[model samples]
Target: MTLDPEDEKILTLARSARARNGTAEGAAVRDETGRTYVATDVNLPSLRLTAVQVAVATAVSSGAQGLEAAALVSDAEEPAQEDLAAVEDLGNAILFHAGLDGSLKGRYV
Candidate 1:
């Protein structure tokens, strides 16, 4: 789905972080632990992340491929148990809203 302007800006920060650093920074990446202390660091009213952190987060939220890469980079357990379903729902909503529905097939998003 296409991201809103605010989300787009935030993701831009994330992308920039990845471009600058090879991977997540400061907070640490762990397969079992998920993204520790990341929200705490970036959780501000501004809703922004350090370029370094954004890179890692962007990668994590990149969807299917991201899920695989994140699995390798660190053992982050994924978003919270509750947040997972919500995220999935959001994705579906975006698809439906964009008229892709279940018919995108190969039409290209």
Candidate 2:
């Protein structure tokens, strides 16, 4: 799908986070206020969180009441159910899926 520049920015940020962290997944979320948050899969021994969950949590912690959009860059066929739930908790936001190479794949809402 064609993304607006703002959405494209988040997609690029998600792509870069995955590349930089060498993680299985990376995600970025844009809040209603136009603020964006990025995160990679967290698999520490004490805690495990999908990139989407982390990004959404970060936005919530930062006082974002709602999200405008989100992007996930991963090789997985689809975003995890838990990840989708995380996004839903905040509000309805289109979740753009992208490949490791940063190509647009699909979108979920």
Q: What is the C-alpha lDDT of each candidate?
A: 0.28, 0.94
Candidate 2 per-residue lDDT, tens place, 55-106, comes to 9999999999999999999998888899889999988999999999999888
> Which residue pairs show backbone clashes in model 2?
none
Number of backbone-clashing residue pairs for each candidate, in the order shown = 10, 0
TM-score of each: 0.26, 0.97
| Candidate 2 lDDT score at position 57 | 94
The best candidate by TM-score is 2
Model 2: lDDT equals 0.94
Off by over 4 Å in 2: none
Candidate 1, which segments miss by more than 4 Å at Cα? 24-109
